[model samples]
Target: MTTTANTSHNIVFLDRDSLIANVRRPAFSHSWTEYGATAASEAAGRLAGASIAITNKVPLRADTLAQLPDLKMIAVAATGTDIIDLAACKERGIVVSNIRDYAYASLPEHTFALILALRRNLLAYRADVQAGQWQKSDKFCLFDYPITDLAGSKLGLLGYGALGHAVARLGRAFGMDILVHKRTPVEEEGIRSVSWDELLETSDVLSLHAPLNEQTRNIIGSTELARMKRSALLINTARGGLVDEAALAAALTTGIIAGAGFDVLVKEPPPEDNVLLNLHLPNFILTPHIAWASTQAMQILADQLVDNVEAFVANKPVNVVG
Candidate 1:
């Protein structure tokens, strides 16, 4: 653990509006300053005199950290720490902690929501209904969109952590077979362990639950997408960079696979030129990275964020990551 010389600390929350829950002050002698949002240029200025920094999506790169000599610790408001430079923090003796297992319920539910929506062609059918296609139909029902059942279909999970386990349980409830490819060995019953190639080729629905990192970034590119079944559905509730945005846009346009549902994008608040943003396919669903932002889940995350901060101040930091 990195120890600070100061008796009291200055804590600054860089992006307070990212979280929708109440963040109670830490149980220590510290000054707290919060901003609704922080841009890249404003980061160094906001965190100038701070000993501790709280951030959700704001980037704390090597250059920004170099300016904040007083920074002793970084309390990440979310699980993903890619926004902060871990190597830089390690070299500076800055303790970096992140929230863990906070989105177990909301994440899995959202993943399945995407899966079910794509499988049943819910969005396509909804658009048809809104366009009065159902009203103009001669038959009792409209079958313009092909609907598939989740039962007996294979559910492939990329990373089998707490979130993966929760998703597998839901798949089972929906009568879907579970197949997983994870770094660790599979020890759970009824879950079949498969190679990366087999998982890609076999699953009816391939869901990503892995964190964004060097090895996992752009893991699902053109070749990986081509390996999947033409009827397969791609679901990504995890990080956006896991799939190449241009490649995904091409795949969706070319019909390499059936469809996709994503809660994240490579660049959040994506620019006008983003390929995925320009795609107007009914099969492709792009949610604004709110898979883990349910009211219940945000409160859990908010409570845990304070816990991480409190633990670090007491010299017993939990969820301490790179």
Candidate 2:
């Protein structure tokens, strides 16, 4: 193979539809080939001569990476790079980049959506109303469900990053007291900081915005649930592994906590046998990992994806993770 400095580099975007919103292909000083769908078996053959590959959820493991000799960079359309093998990329001198902070708007909004729904028992009430329970009652409204207000409630934030801070602002806007649990033990930062135990015990609404890593995985389990107020609602809009799903089901079933809302699961499309799927509890709300799919956020990510690719071509890549 011959290398030409002035020749157009080949760029490919695998699984372009993985992005919920439109992605403006980055202005590349190269020819681009995009596939709306790319199977694992066809990845190497399709990318044989490509210089850059962009993927969102498609697996680019060592086996796939081994076959592409011309590949130089991978632009991940999303923040999480767990689908890609970073060590292999490092060893092979392949630059990897991912979008960051794109979900600051969408995720926080989704988190509160879950929190508000769970706190107000919206689902149960809706179900009751649909079941004609209100019509059967002699009273104007039935007290078969509990309805709570967000005001004066303590909002326990598990992560203090951008999303967590956004959630705090929303909580405060609703006149809810915001309490953040420090990731590490340090001197309290006045009213803003509190011990983990304090956040767990006193909060009326607990929300998790942390990532999934070895240290943070399963951070919310049976023991942590035990520390929470019985009337508290737990919300996780961050990652799935951060909470033990089975344990959470047990907690919900046993009334360990008042209610829970989650936007993610340990498995994306959870297996049919997953314990949480079988639970028809009105307190449990599970969304299909769409907290970050807001239109505005998706557009921002699309623009940034192109920016990263353009930067990489210019030897000045931004958002490089490896």
Candidate 3:
């Protein structure tokens, strides 16, 4: 939390348009600059002379950090800190803080929106209706797609943090039996702690809520997909790197698993050639990383973001990540 003596802090926000919420200024004296969007090549130049930088998705790597000797703090506008090089920050004595637990309601609700849509074949049926199958049917309703109930199904959860707990509660509300995979033993009441293999093989609906890191990237790939029941559904509102995109495309195309709903990708604004983007399967759903973008959630994040900056100015930084 060190700063130049009696100087106004120079704060710059890169990619300000990534958030739709109103960001209030920190309480202390400071100067602020913001851009609607920023690219990797332009990061260092834009952050030049900036002591405090706010970013949502623009990466701040070791090479970039090397150029900013005056930088004291990085306030990540989101929960994930993978975009920030923690090792480099620590080495440079830079404090990093991130927003946390602000999306508890929005994220879990979005997770179930995917689950219910996939389980009940809502998209498939809607497609059928658009294709005139319902009107051309011999019966009152078309039965071209399979519909399943979540009431008695097993809901598997990976990573049981705040968002995970919220998702688990929703699963219980739907009368699903909850199964969690944790590195350590799970002692929570009415929740079954299972091995990773067991979770993959037994869950009728698998939801990922883990962070993306060296140990978690591509946790669900070809082998894991092949082990799942052909009727099971996969939901990921967490990190995109948690699942292998190429493997997921193949699995959905070949019917290895019933369906999948994802809100993230390893690369945001995915490339034109990304396999998942090319898949036109009705069972697969992809959102533009908006599970955490509900109006209320965005405001909560914005408020907390200012809180982090203000706390650091007071030398009592809250939610310091690294």
lDDT of candidates 1 onward, in order? 0.92, 0.85, 0.93
Residue 188, model 1: lDDT of 80
Q: Against the correct fold, how does model 1 do in TM-score?
A: 0.96
The candidate with the higher lDDT, 1 or 2, is 1
**TM-score per candidate, chains pooled:** 0.96, 0.91, 0.97
Better of 1 and 3 by TM-score: 3
lDDT of 1 by residue, 62-86 (tens): 9999999999999999989999999
* Regions more than 4 Å wrong, model 1: 1-7
Q: Which lDDT tens digits does candidate 2 get at residues 75-94?
A: 99988887788989999999
**lDDT for 135 (candidate 2):** 88
Taking all chains together, the TM-score of candidate 2 against the true structure is 0.91
Candidate 1 Cα RMSD after full superposition onto the native fold (Å): 3.3
Question: How much does each candidate deviate from the true structure in C-alpha RMSD?
Answer: 3.3, 3.5, 2.9
* Maximum-TM-score candidate: 3
Higher-TM-score candidate of 2 and 3 = 3
Q: What is the lDDT of residue 148 in candidate 1?
A: 94
The TM-score obtained by model 3 is 0.97
